[model samples]
Target: MNTGRVVLITGTSSGIGLAAAVQAAQAGYTVVATMRDTTRSDALLKAAAEAGVTVDVRRLDVTDPESVAACVTAVADSYGRLDALVNNAGRANTFATIETCDLATYREVIEVNFLGVVAVTRAGLPHLRAAGGRIVTVGSTRGLIGQPFNEGYSAAKFAVEGFMESLAPTAAGMGVRVVMVEPGPVFETAFGANSGLTRESLLTEAGPYRRVLEPYLDWVARGAHPGAQTGREIAEHIVTALTDPEPPFRVLTSDWAREYTAIKYTDPEGGRVRAMTASWLAREED
Candidate 1:
């Protein structure tokens, strides 16, 4: 029962992207799983095998315009149509306050997280419009509520959320659906491992900010948030966002994530979220 639908996914080498590729393939979509380097695709291949499905692997570095265009072209040529696109390629930044974070780190995060989606979406638009397809981007809860040490990553996701919102109406008119899947903490993922980032590396000079940074770091060490979701759980929501006839414009990965983001709407002035974060930073040891 092949759906005859083709979906091109970015960053499929591991974690949520890999899980979505396998799930989409098992659900009968012709899955084009792409990563910056195909050399890291063993995990994806193995996952697909375990799921008793096959996915076409390709090289797609979202940060590179040439690579993005080539990958989209190759998927269109090889598959004849692209029915869906999952914009999931991203990089986590070193935990640092804006004052301490390097400009280069911010640039790198924005290039990959925000501009990468722009590039890939630009290339895939014609094909998607032709197929009346869906565009699902993997965003983060931090996009709605800023966190202590996630300034750069959150900024990129905030841009993504805004970009998608601006594009959705026009795309709907052109018969393309746009969606964003926002996830909270994900477990058993290597996203931050290779980012060449650590909290310690970010604090070269403790200065006066150490007081604020110390508690957040201590909280994180004691489990930042309990009951974090796994990559597979987030991927499931992404699959649903793609396949549902009337898919939601925003899909938060968990109940907690949804509740957390809802605070923004409850208080548009940013008072509630600000207060909550301040409370977290001010909490004393138990």
Candidate 2:
């Protein structure tokens, strides 16, 4: 048990962040769960109560530098030390090819998914180093291989993977663990709804790409891959990463995600993942 060790997690209003907070608290970690708005905290509070553990919920808009600095300052003032930080706040762009994606859309996703992690980590590094703590950021399988219409989101995650890979070695020198937990197509979360990237809203009006996008969206709508993990399962893997003495630099949360990402990284040719994913879309279209 990490009794009294403080862990600050972003995006705890729902999904993986909420579960991670509840689970970490139950495991004896003092949890600080922050979301953009506190009004959405009801579900997290309820889950903490049900788990018989307490979580300190606060408002933190990760995209805003002021909010990030103020939240970190408040945490430092209150707890004086932070043992771990879970950078889970992310924004996904609606489906669009690179050519069609607006610059503002790309910036929005990068602001939350990439820069947000950097901001939070920078603010928490001193305290984390003091405790030899961990930094776990929730990335995506898309970080390994880009999907056709997910350019903005995928690019942000890829940047996160690159940034963390660069920072991991330096963080190790400071006795701090920096890791990325990559998950694929998680279910039981309003991520699509919350991210403002629902398939219907994006693909229904795909225009020129409708022929290819519709099939992919239909397959997803039909739930072709039933092995998608729940938020709690992903959170459990995150907790393991946090507690393990020597955790991996990157954690693929599901067997499926691991297998698929392996195809991209293990193959030096770098064509296998593209071919395989393209086949899925082609088959669906057919």
Candidate 3:
């Protein structure tokens, strides 16, 4: 039981964030579950109730520096200590090739998915260092192997990978443990729905890229992929990363995710990844 250890999590209105919050609280940590809008916290509250745990729900907009600072300050002031930080707040980009995606969309994706993590981490680091705490960021397989039509999202996640990987050692020097929990496709999350995209709409909007988009979407729509996991499953990994005394720098949520990302490490010339992801866009007959 973590007891009085206070852990702050961002984007807890739903999905991995909410699950992690409840699970962390269940595991006996003082969980501060935060989201941009507190009004959307009903689901999280319900989940916590069902889990026989309670969480401190708060409002935190990671994209806004003031919100980030204020939330962290309030947590510190209220608890007098912070034990961990879970960077789970992020948005999925609408499906579009780089050439087809507007610059504004690209910036928005980067801002929320990448810079938001940065802002929250920067604000929480001091408190975390004081308690010898942990920083667990929810990473994606798209970060390891870039997807065809998800240019903005993949780029942002890839940036997160680099940032966390580089900061892990430095944070460790300050008695802070940083870990990245990499999940492949996650089910029961707002990720897909939040994109506000459907197969028909994407197909119609794909323009010249429809041929490629069709196969990719088909691959995605083939029910659950081998590496796919539920948000609860991914949250379990996050909680482990938070509580494990000697957690690894990277936590792959599933065996499939481990095997999938392993390709990048072994492929020196990037040929294997290029060929594999390209296959996702190839018609079945091809």
Instruction: Give the Cα error of residue 65 in candidate 2, in Å.
Output: 1.0
lDDT of 2 by residue, 185-238 (tens): 888776777766666667656777777777776766788665599999999988
Per-candidate local distance difference test:
0.89, 0.86, 0.92
What is the alpha-carbon lDDT of model 3 when measured against the actual structure? Answer: 0.92
**Residue 170's C-alpha lDDT in candidate 1?**
95
User: Model 1 compared with the native: what TM-score?
Assistant: 0.95
Candidate 2 segments exceeding 4 Å error: 196-200, 283-286
In Å, residue 30's CA in model 3 sits off its true spot by: 0.8
Better of 1 and 3 by TM-score: 3
Model 1: per-residue Cα lDDT over 115-166, one tens digit each: 9999999999999999999899999988888887788888998999999999
Give every collision pair in model 1: none
Location of the lowest summed lDDT over 10 successive residues in candidate 1 = 198-207
Flag clash pairs in model 3: none
Worst 10 residues of 3 by lDDT: 219-228
lDDT of 3 by residue, 67-157 (tens): 9999999999999999999999998777998777789989999999999999999999999999999899998999988988989999999
